[model samples]
Target: MKFNFLAKEKNTVVNYENAVAFPLTPDYELYAAVVTTSLNASFYEKDTTRLERIKDLIQKSNPVFVAKLAVYARNEMHMRSVPLVLIVELAKIYSGDSLISKMITQVIQRADEITELLAYYQMANERNGVKKLNRLSKQIQKGLANSFNKFDEYQFAKYNRDGAVKLKDALFLVHLKAKDEAQQVLFNKIVNDALQTPYTWETELSKVGQLKYYNEAEKQKAFTQKWEELIDSNKIGYMALLRNLRNIVEANVSRYHISKVCDYLSNEKAVANSKQLPFRFLAAYRELKELNSKYVPMILDALEEAVMASAQNIKGFDVSTSVVIACDVSGSMQKNISPKSKIMLYDIGLMLGMLLQSRCKDVVSGMFGDRWKIINMPKRAILSNVNEYYKREGEVGYSTNGYLVLEDLIKRNEIVDKVMLFTDVQMWNSNMTKDSFAYSWNRYKAIAPNAKLYLFDLAGYGQTPINVEKNDVYLIAGWSDKVFDVLNALDDKNSALNYINRIEL
Candidate 1:
């Protein structure tokens, strides 16, 4: 028998599209909101709206669960900003014990996050205009003070530059007793602005950028050499390398360095260690592809290998289990995920949909908008398939007609073990009848009794496109490849909240 978990009936809420949908429980809502955020505006919601919704959810959800989610998002999911936001928001109302301080130690993984947390604390507590931070949250101050021990003088100096809340400001705000005489001296340096400048990727690049060249070709040559030097010195990080592939290509870096890049990118261990969201590879691929450089093919091959490496742990089923992956290429999905990003929500859907397709042995994948048309795809060429879908998304007009996927399957009397919909989950039916996604799902389930539906929520608008509580349906939220791990837990009769609850604080 399939794993079945039950919960109290969830109330309905009208989504941004004015469609009837099921509202997620507070913990589920918080997970969705936290994981899918880049702390920026999505298609239908502004940044402030998203922040307010998260704050309100934190106010109502269990404090322990909220703390665990913050740690999970930071350490496991490899998110930076949202986890800090979770800690800050949680601190505004929760101080029953050392939970806030412990959460800070767990969530603030990097030195820069120390300042970031304080900045957020300042903003959230409305202490921006105040001359002194005497009224800062004591729990937060304790957390920040403990956090200072995790970094060294050079690490602290790197991010101590100008910002809303400087590292020095944080030093004064949290009067941490130094762990040792050396640490005390480092703290003194932090306050006196006398820390030595550490040689880093940023510092090296800044030095190169200060040089003046005689002509455009000379300037290009200088940059090309600098990039090669950085690569040779191993100063460029995995993520930095991914984001700068286009720069490397444009600067006409040597083929030898390009080979090193491809080698590093394709290394499975490096890919896993980077903890980059799958969309980052897609963004790099898309940008590099537009350059029309000969190295595009080499870099694209490396990226394809990297993304597939990242997908190695995605759960799969036997050939007997039939699956269909449907992606939403609706109009709203065309909007970029962030203000300065070229990656769109639909791109994420396509990348993840295509990645899942690569893992499944027996699967039919296609995109849905005004209509759902099945497209045969190769299992190995994940990024290529996503590009194919991106090029042809316009073929089906943009109307969010997700029901058509099921409606077509029902008409054909096809029985699939699983139907996965990668979408923003703002699904609406203009023909609002039994043909809606929910109604169509009910009809389809009746024909195929063991069928289950999974919604891969890309935008996390806090509402399901269909009722998820009663049906054998599941919702997985996030832009990371790690989100797919939830599938195995779900098959073991675990809910998302259960998954978060299992996180040991």
Candidate 2:
């Protein structure tokens, strides 16, 4: 939908001519749009104008979202180079927000370049109005100790000795000496230990055997014994298990070993302790399904239990409003949002649609592209329903005809309290009709006068098919499930604006 008040004004009168120009996007929407669109050049490289507009928006948007965008880029997208630009821009707008310090630590932990880490530390020091010697030393030590790359370890140590010392006061050297001594000891141990290689679930299990000296045959026996002890001991955390599922399968351990690991990882106690999201469990299920290993069934069953257990933490909407979730499964959605990431826009749309459906008692879920049809989702687990929906409808069409969703619902005389369309907002009427989305929306409005349409934009196309001001339509964009958290505030008449203003700086 067009936001007319955001246009650059030539006079006091509203600039209707520049209505299609860049509008004042809400902080959440801007953050979501930029973070998702910035993942790859495929989205922005083709449309330089949209890219420039987003960049301009970032320069003027709130710094809180800027920090959030940077964290999302690093943690969620696994990005290295792209987030640096945002981090640099964020440093320019820094105003002593503690969030910036957290972002700095994340960057230091994940960044490959020592120079980038140093730059972030300098910014942190400036914001805190003091050289944070202890904090910086701890962050550096943590990064070095956790690093799997030899080069990164060396670089972090080198920076700690040469670069960090120069930036700090002479009094800081006392603490630095202690940190240095600890680092040297840790580094020597890491280098001398053969089992201190990349720490994975399997590797951690192997470490148990390395705890004591033993012959080859004796070590094998000890490993088996220790593996069972560790499994039964409940020492392995859920994140360790979730991230290293492949390692566990490829270890070729006995079925009993695998079953025990799965049982502990997916148990209610572990799920509650780990605080893993339902979508993360769903993602794990998808990965295991693709592997098609012998343990797939067992792992899926365990993960299903974990997902159900974790669902209690997700606060579903308490409103008694009928809802319909229309997901876009068009060709554009197949494009990867991030480089080397298997998660595409289509996968995210489906997952979010199913997530919303799972939260609602009366919700109609459907997929749309060139055509539209109601999906018959069974009352089962969330991931099961998603898999079943995909199996029933192999693939939706290519073109993004979002209008067809409203049209089909209107034709069937199915008036819902709300229609949530998860799409890129690049809707076209394949029927060669004018204003098809608007036409169908108006017709639906005739029947359901109070019904609202929420267009969840996965891609930042900067355009919409319907006029939001004239119709009860709202736009929310982002890649994370946090985007859904704004729905409660959206129930107000002001929509996202109210939520944006209420966001803590």
Q: lDDT: which candidate is best? A: 1
lDDT of 2 by residue, 258-303 (tens): 8897777667777766745344666677778878577878888887
* Candidate 2 residue pairs that clash: none
lDDT of 2 at 408: 77
Cα TM-score per model: 0.94, 0.69
Question: For model 1, what is the alpha-carbon lDDT of residue 102?
Answer: 89
- Residue-level lDDT tens digits of model 1 in 386-493: 999988978888888899999999999999999999999988886656566888899999999899899988888899978674578889888877778877678637
- What global local distance difference test value does model 1 have? 0.86
Q: Candidate 1, 10: how far from true, in Å?
A: 9.8
In model 2, the runs with Cα more than 4 Å from the true position are: 1-29, 35-38, 42-54, 64-85, 93-237, 254-256, 264-280, 290-294, 314-319, 392-395, 467-470, 494-505
